[model samples]
Target: MSPSASFSDVVRDRRAVRSFLDKAVPDDVLRAVLDEAQLAPSNSNTQPWIVHIARGTARDRLSEALLRADDEERYSLDFPYDGSAYEGAYARRRQDQAKALLDALGVSRDDEAGRRLAARRNLEFFGAPQVALLCVPGFAGARITADAGMYAQTFLLSLAARGLGGVAQTTIGFYADTVREALGLPDDHKLLFSMSFGYPDKRWTAQTPRTYRASLEESVHFHE
Candidate 1:
C-alpha cells in the first residue's frame, strides 16, 4: 500500500484484480498480511476459516487439474452455487458486471469461442503467482459460513494494505474435489472459496474496470 493511504483509501481501492505479473510475493510480506487478517472476528471467537495457499509448482499442477476436471464436466462442490437464483437489482448487477469484463477485454457477446476462453481464464488464476483456498470442516454450517465471509474480506483488505491484489473465486469451490485430491487435503474439508493474488500486471489491470458498489440507500437502513 502507499505510505500515504488511509483506511478509506484502502477500502476504496481494493477490487478484484483480474490480471497479475509473473513475480512472486515475498514470504515476509505475505506472512504480515495473513497475520493481520487473522484478527478478523468470528462467531463466538471460533475462527473456522482454514486457508490453504498454493504457489510455484504446486499451484501450476492444481490449475491443470482444475482445467481437466472442468473439461470432463466433473464437479464436487461443497456448497451450491449458481448465478441464476437471484432477481431484481442483484441480477442486473451480475449482468452488468459480466458485460463490463467482456467489454474491457474486447470480447464480443456473439463470439462464443472468445467468451469461453475468457471464462476459462479463471481456472488459470489469470496467471497470478499465488492462490489461496479457504476451507472449513464439514461440520461448519450457515452461521460459520458468515464468519468465513468476514475472514475473507479481512484478508482482501490486508492484501490491499500490502499493495497486493486478489480476487475471491467461488468457481474454485465447484472443483473442490479436484483441488483436495491434488493438494492432499483431508477428505472431510469443505472448500468455501479460493482467490488468486499477486502484484498486478499494470498493462492488463489498466484494461479492466473497477467493481462498483450499490448506493447506501439500496443496502443500508436505520430506524429511530
Candidate 2:
C-alpha cells in the first residue's frame, strides 16, 4: 500500500472493516491521513466538518456512555433514522448487507439475543484503538452535510492508502447528545457519524463479508 498506488487500488482495497487489532496507529501517520483528507473540496471552501478523535481513556468513556444509552434505549439523534425509509431496493440491500455480516459472525436472524449483542459492537468501536467522531453544524441543511460526507469519504480513502482500515457507523449518531457531552463539544457541533480505525484484524472473518454493488446501468443515469 504505497502512497504512489493508483486510485483504483485504494478504492478497491477500501471496505468497511468491522474488526481491528489493538495496535495503536502512530501519531504522524494519523496526522498525515487527516492532512490529506483536509484536501477534500467543500461548499464555498467552508470546511464545515469537525472531527474529534478519542483514544485511551477518552475512548473508553465515550464508548461506555454510548453503551449505557443503548442499554437504556435512549437516543438523542440530531437527524432522523427510520427503518421504514428503506423501501423497495433499499430495503433489500439493507437486509442483504446485515445478513452478510451476521452470517459471518455466526448469528442467525432468529437469535434475538445474539443480534442484540452483535448490534452493541458498534458502540464498542469494533475493538479499534481510535474512534473519530465527525460533526457538522446543527442548523446546516443537507447541502452542508453533503460536504461533510465528501470529507468523510476522503478521510476513509486516505486511511486505506496508508494500509489502515475503518468502519463508519451512523449508529453512533443515535446518541448524539451523549457523544457531545462526553466530548465537551458546543451545542452547534452536531454529530454526523463516527468511525473506528486502526490496523485491521485478519483473524476476524466477519471483517471480510461478501458484498456487492449494483451494476452501472442500474445505478447510473446516462444523457446524450
Model 2: per-residue Cα lDDT over 1-224, one tens digit each: 33776899999878898888999889999999999989999989999898999999999999999999998988998988898888988899999999998988889999999999999999999999999999998787898899999999999999988889988999999999999888798999989899899998877844556589988888899899
Regions of model 1 farther than 4 Å from truth: 1-4
Per-candidate TM equals 0.96, 0.96
Question: Can you write out model 1's per-residue Cα lDDT over 21-59, one digit (the tens) per residue?
Answer: 999999988888888879999989999989999999999
Q: Which lDDT value does model 2 have at 117?
A: 94
Pairs that collide in candidate 2 are none
Each model's lDDT comes to 0.90, 0.90
lDDT minimum window of 10 residues, candidate 1: 1-10
